[model samples]
Target: MKNKIKLCILLLFSLSISAQKSNKPSTFERYLQTKELVNVQLIDSSIRADLKYATTDNFAKTILYDTLFNIYAHPVAAEKLAKAQKYLKELNPELSLLVYDAVRPLSVQKKMYKVVQNTKYAAYVANPSRTGLHNYGMAIDLTICDNKGQPLDMGTSFDFFGRAAGINKEAELVAEGILTKQQVKNRNLLRKVMTRAGFLTIRGEWWHFNAVSLSEAKRLYKIIE
Candidate 1:
């Protein structure tokens, strides 16, 4: 009976060790919290510099826009962003990632009004109507730039919500010269960038992408920050 008891205790200890291993922080998580890369620029640098106080739920502080209204998840988001950036760089060296939004600090909601003013897409921009992937800091919306850093015209502006924004249709129109070819080329380039990053485009928006591995994104990130 004593020998049986000892075996049972050993079994329990083994299970405990396994559980501990499973719960340990991930390498991505550690790297997210510590390592910083020179090539990966924070698109929100101006927002972070401007606010200087707000932080995302995930602890990524605001850099450009008012985080009081839009807090961002920490640079932990840098992992996926880096992956996306790599794809963008390859597609067109001139195109880089610029975060239109990230974490929202409740305090900045008042200031947010000014930012969204008179914009056709303001409703989508102002509040978290749905769980913004940006809230998770796992999503990015970017535009392409020219050698001079000027944004090329995609069929619609970055957050445009209209029929003209249809990716496939616009691609065809641009091909036919119904729309300026550069606009179509720009859209195709953006699509290629997301595809290379392992992302698939949704039917609705040219500017948005869900990381290819939706489950992985959910597992790797939380919504708060």
Candidate 2:
């Protein structure tokens, strides 16, 4: 009887430790496994890149981008992006900027920028896992056109977050009035096109869109590398 009681106590102790450990973040929590991704290249930049930033512990701020600076998105998110691009072209045939960053290759550096910073929130670090959506390769980040094919203003820079980064908030310095009321209309036009192609937008950030449908919620992944 004493041995059985001791065994029960030991089991409880083990379970308690596991629960505590689970609360702490680990690299494995932020990376996906090889079986969970689909590999493809959808970005049309100088270097096709795709990778997102996140930590194994928490997901307060997730930053997805191409392999280079000022790029974002993954290749798996291409369908909607293509739709948006086509619609944008229709709005302005002269717009000739190409898609740059999508999914990042693991060989590159991994770091998630704090899109929005506050005392309440902590930034996430990058963990390259074979299981991440970028591994499947379909997301993308886009820039606007300079005569030389550079990105233009939406509000904040590519991965910026804050009141100034608000999709609806107007910032003269960052956006250069690019996302004005008319610009929002133009953006909405692109949004409509993407929605038709199966993408959904979040209210807080104008640049963010998700391709997962309600039915595919289970498939929406949350793995650590």
Candidate 3:
């Protein structure tokens, strides 16, 4: 019947239009959608995320990312993070990893660098031109939280740009009574779990960890725009 054929054609055309609209993501949506990145929450919901850059609580005192954009990490890094979470549970079932920042865009990195450029904190933030592991989605800033979801004291808070936050200064601080023995113990525990899961820490930051060397990350991965 001609009427039946016309109805079927109209339905097909409508479905095709819907498909085209769905395929064309907005600029912001495309920015958040990357094949190389994985939503950490989707992989392991138990690992908590605060996402500092999404809020104005960061050192810059400005919101860097859209809050709707979920925390993301390179697939390799996400797997390692999942392993780290499992390791943390094995160490103490009540403890969990809390992510502060992960998979930062280069645009955000430049903003962070500008804020600390001329200050004493310049060394704490990496130069965007050099493109650090975080720019490549291979780094994470995180800390451990206890059963009650309270972050463990690491002698210094996240994004603390001082010698006290340096991993190498833990012993010195503990000796000077600036850092408690328990704080050092907590930092060590975090380091242990992350290292065992194939993440490496930098001497200058206790909260920062790289899933791969900076060179390796730059060579193998595309920097998230």
Candidate 4:
């Protein structure tokens, strides 16, 4: 009877140790371990980050992210960004990529949709139901900055939600004098570097780019929440 009682105590102690180990934090238990998302800053500190969604300065006019800092992306996407940063440095040592948004959670997407839904701008913000590339950590909203960390004017500001912000409208805007040739050149420079690094730009937003297709993102990764 005493042996059986001692065995029961040992079993309980083993289970307790197992639980403690499971709860213990390890060096590998980092944001990168999330499988689909990797903290870009962890991989490359040179990349500038603004993260407008983390502040009320965005089109939503509200803070969307739970944390006030840190940008995350799919490992594949982050690798391409690192390459793009390297290319940018080669082209102009003073220039660096500044990120505005990355790896938006589905909860934040719902917040964005709530504000733009039923409006003409609704098309710019993807519906939460279908889940966009950003929800899967595969999209980025970014721009280029100089050594002083000042963003180069890309014709229209990020999240302008107008025809002026469209990549397709650059020529028309330049011809109309609304956007100078220099501004278009700056935008194209950003595109050149990003495309060289395997990112695809969207038609309506100059600041937006996808590391992978929507179909591929949906098929290959789970949405971040």
TM-score of each candidate structure, all chains considered together: 0.53, 0.46, 0.83, 0.82
lDDT of 2 by residue, 24-104 (tens): 322332232232332222233232222224222223334432212223333345545655656656767655334433444
Ten-residue segment with the worst summed lDDT in candidate 2?
Answer: 48-57
Off by over 4 Å in 1: 1-64, 67-77, 87-95, 103-129, 171-178, 212-220
lDDT of 3 by residue, 1-225 (tens): 999999999998776557434544434435656556777777887998888887788887877775334568899899999999999999899999999988888888898888877777787777888788887789999999988889998989998877888888788888888889999999999999999999999998999999999888777778887
Runs in model 2 deviating more than 4 A are: 1-76, 96-101, 104-139, 168-179, 182-186, 213-217, 220-224
The total number of steric clashes, by the backbone 3 Å criterion, in model 4 comes to 0
Q: If ranked by TM-score, best first, what sequence of candidates would result? A: 3, 4, 1, 2
Give per-residue lDDT, candidate 2, residue 91. Answer: 63
Report model 4's TM-score to 2 decimal places: 0.82
Clashing pairs in 3: none
Clashes of each: 20, 31, 0, 0
Arrange candidates, best lDDT first: 3, 4, 1, 2
User: What lDDT tens digits, residue by residue, belong to model 1 across residues 2-80?
Assistant: 9999999999877655643454433333333342311124333221111122223111222333112222343545455
True-structure RMSD for candidate 4: 11.0
Clashing pairs in 4: none
Which RMSD does model 3 reach against the true structure?
9.8
